[model samples]
Target: MRFCILGLVEVQDERSGLRVLPTGAKQRALLAALVVKAGHEISARRLIDELWGGHPPANAANALQIHVARLRRLLSGPAERDADQPERRPWIETTGHGYALRLSPAETDAARFQHLTDQGRRALLHDPGQAGELLGQALSLWRGPALQGSVLGDICADEATRLDEHRLAALEMRYDAYLRTGRHGEITGELVDLTLQHPTRERFYDLLMVALYRCGRQAEALAVYERARTRMRHELGVEPGPALRELMRRILHHDPALARTPGPRPADPSQPRATPAPADDAALSLGDEMARLHRRIERLQREQDQLLRCFRELTASAAQRDMSVNWEGS
Candidate 1:
C-alpha cells in the first residue's frame, strides 16, 4: 500500500486501489505521525505526548501498540490479504528507540512531489516547457491540503505547513514557465484567481501584471499594480517591493521590452546541448584574455618568421655580392 500524504493521508493499492483506512481520528493521526517521521525512530514518550496532548492514558504504551498493530494491518493491501503466499515483512519496524514507519521516498506522494518540483525548478530557464510539465505533475499530486482530514500532531502539522509552502512555490514556478513559454494569455485568468487566493503573495501579482501587458491589456496591467499597491499599503503599511514597482514603472512608460516574444524553445533531447554562455564576468574576461593572447602569440610568430626570412635573404644577397667581388678579383 502506498501512503499518500500530499493530499489526504490515504492509502493506494496497485491491484484493488483506494483502501479505506481506520475511521478513528487518533488512528489516522498515529499513521500520519509515523509517515511524516518515516524511516526515523520515534520514542514511545514522544508519540504518546503527541497523540494524547499531555493527557496520555494510564495504558498509553498498550494503546500505542494497538494503534501500531492496526496501521501494520492496514498496510497490507487486498492483494496481500488474498495471497496464499508466504508472510511478508511488516511495514512498521520496532526499534530500540521505539517504532519507525518503514517507508522510502518512492512510497509517498509528498516525496515525489518534492522531487518533481526540484526538477522543474532546475529546468525553468532553459527547458521551460518540460519544466512546466514537471511542475504541473508535482502540483497535481496535491489533491487538497497536505495530510487533509487527518488529526495532526506537531510533527505532522509542521510537515503539512512545509509541504503547503512548497506547493505554492511550485505553483509560482510553473506559472513562470508557462509565461516564458508564451502561454501568457492562457495563464492570466488563473493568475487573477491566484492573486485572490493568496493576496499576500506578491509574486503572483507581478506575474499577472506581466501576463496582462503581454495580452495587450495595458490598462488592466497598470490596474493590477494599483490593486497590489493598495492592498499592501492598506494591510501591511508598506509599498510594493522593488520588483513590482519596477514592473509598474516599465508598464507605465510603455517599455518595448515588455512585449511578448516567443517562449523558450524546447531543447532537443537527442542532441547534446551547447555549452552555456559564461555567467560570470571574470570568467568571460579570462576567456577573452586567453583568446587575445593566442592571437598575439600567432602574430608574434608570424613576425619572427618574416624577420628570419629577411635575414636569410640579406645573407644570401651579401654572399652573392662577395662571390661577384671574388669573381671580379679573379
Candidate 2:
C-alpha cells in the first residue's frame, strides 16, 4: 500500500494499483493523523484530539478503534475484497498505547518529495545539472497544494504549510539551476506565474527581473522592480530586499556583466557585415537610437534658444522705435 499526501490523503494498493482510500471523514482523518507521523506511534489521546479536536464523542476511544479498523481493512490491499482469504498482516500495527502505520520513505509522495529535494540540494553545488534533474522530478510529484482535498487539523495544517514552503524552495532552486545554465528566457513565464502566485516573495521578483533583463527587456525588468518596490512599500511598509535593490541598480546602469554571454554570430555572408545579429542588433539599435534622440533634443534646445533671442531683439527694436516716435510727437 502507498500513501499519497502530496495532493490528497489516499492509499493506493500496490498489487492492484488502485486507490482504496476510506471515504468517511473521521476515517480519513485518523489515517491522516497516523500518516503525518508515519513511523512513530501516536497516542490515542493525541489521535482523538487530531480527529475530533475538543469535541470527541462519548465513546471516542471506540470510535477511534472503529476508524482504525476501517483503515486497516482498506490498507490490506485488494484481498480485503475477497472473503475467501483475509490478509493477515495489517499496515497499521497496534502498539501498547496506540498505533503506528508502517510506511517507507518511498511509500508516501510527500516523503519521497522531501527525500528528492534533499538529495537535489546536496547535489546543487557540485552538479547543477543533476540537481535540476532531481529537483524537477521532486516538483513534478506535486499535483496541487499539500493535502489538496483533505481537511487539515492543526498538525496537518502546519505540516502542509511546511511542505508547501519546501516545494517553493525546491522550485526556486530548480530555477536557479536553469539560470546558471543561461536558460533565463525559458523560465521567465514560469517565474512570472510564481511571482504572481507569491507576490510577497522577493526571490521570485528578483528572478523575473533577471530573466527579463537577460532577454533584452531592460525597461520591463525595471518596471517589475518598481512594482515589487511599490507593493512592498504599500502593503508591507518596507523596501525591497538587498538582492532586488542591487539588481535594479545594475539594470539602471545597464551593467555589461548581466549580458556577458555573447550573442549569436550573424548568418548571410553576402549581407553587409555592418548589421549585427539579433541580440547584438538590439543593443546596437538602442545605443544608436539614444544617440539620435540626444542629437534631436540638442538641436531642438538650440532652436528654442535662438527663438528666445530673436524675440528679445524684436522687442528691444520695437521699444526703441516707440521711444523715437514718442520723441518726434513731443
Candidate 3:
C-alpha cells in the first residue's frame, strides 16, 4: 500500500489496484500531517492546531478521535480485501499523545522525489546523461502541488514549499545536465516554458541564453539577457547576479568555450570544479569593455552637468521676467 501526498492525500492498494482516501477536509489534513512525519509521532497539540485551524471545537479530542477512526476504517476496512495483505491493513497507529502513520520512503512519492533529486544532482559532473535520467524520474513523480486539495496547515504548507523548491532545483539540474551533454537545441522550447513559468529565476535565463547562442541565434541569446536584466531590475528591484552578468559578457564576446561542448568530468563531491585559468586575451577584452564603460559614465556625467545648467538658466529667466512684469504693473 502506498500513501501518496505528492498530489492528493490518498492510499493506493497494490494488490486490488484500489485507490482510497479521506473525503473530509480535516480528515485529509490529518492524513497529510501524519504522512509528512511518517513513522514518527506528531504531537497531539500540533495536530489539533493544524486540524482545527488553531481553534478546535470544545471537544477537540473527541472530534480528533472521530477523524482518526474514520481514517483507520478507510485505510484498513474491507477486511476481505486485505485479509492476505497484513501490511495493507492498519496503517495509522495511536500514540500516547499523538498519532503516526506506519509508512516508509519506499511507499511515499514525496520521499522518493527528494531522494532521486539528491542522487541526480550528485551525478551532474561525472555522468550528465545518467543525471538527466534520474532527475527526469524525480520530476515525473510530481502530479501537482504537494498536499493538494486540503487546506494547507503550517506544517503542510512548509513541506509543500520545500518540496516545490526541490522540484525546481531538480529541473534546473536536469536541464543543466542536458546542456552539459550538448542537447541544448532540443530543449529550447521546454526551457522557454520553464522560463515563462519562473520568469524571476535567473538560472533559466542563463540556460536559455546558452541554448539560443548555440542554436546560432546569438542575437536572440543577447536579447534573452536584456529581458532578464530589465525584468530583474524592474520587478525584483535588483540586478542580475554576477554569474549571470558574466554569462552575458561571455555571450557578447562569443566566448569559444560557451560554444564548445563540455565532456564528462569526474566529480569531487568535496570540492567544486575549479575555475578555468584566466586568459590574457580575456583580460585585454575586459580592459576595453571597462574603458568603454568609463567613457560612457563620463559622458553621462557631462550630460547631467549640461542638464543642470539648462535648468538654472530657465529658472533665472523666469524669475527675471516675473520681476519685470511686477515693475511694469507698479
lDDT of 1: 0.79
> Which candidate's TM-score is highest?
3
The true-versus-predicted C-alpha distance at residue 183 of model 3, in Å, is 1.2
lDDT of 3 by residue, 217-299 (tens): 66666667777877887888987899988997797776989886576665568976434223356445654565466469769
Tens digits of per-residue lDDT for model 2, 78-160 = 54643453443567889989999776667788888989999989877766778889999999988777876555467677788
Judge candidate 2 at residue 228 and give its lDDT: 87
Q: What is the TM-score of each predicted model, taking all chains together? A: 0.75, 0.74, 0.79
Please count the clashing residue pairs in each candidate, in the order shown.
0, 0, 0
TM-score of the candidate numbered 2?
0.74
Instruction: Point out the worst 10-residue segment of candidate 1 by lDDT.
Output: 274-283
Compared with the true structure, model 1 gives a TM-score of 0.75
| C-alpha RMSD by candidate, in order | 20.8, 13.8, 7.6
Per-residue CA lDDT of model 1 for 1-330, tens digit only, reads 567887767777756655656667788888888888888999988898768877889999999999888877877654366465334356788999689977776778888898999999999987888999999999988888988776547878788889899999999999999888778878988999999898878999999988887776666777787788778878899878999888877866557777744345655699874331212454335434544664696699799999999999999999999999999999
| Local accuracy by lDDT, each model | 0.79, 0.77, 0.81
Which candidate do you rate higher for TM-score, 2 or 3? 3
| Pairs of residues clashing in candidate 3 | none
Ten contiguous residues with the weakest lDDT in model 2: 272-281
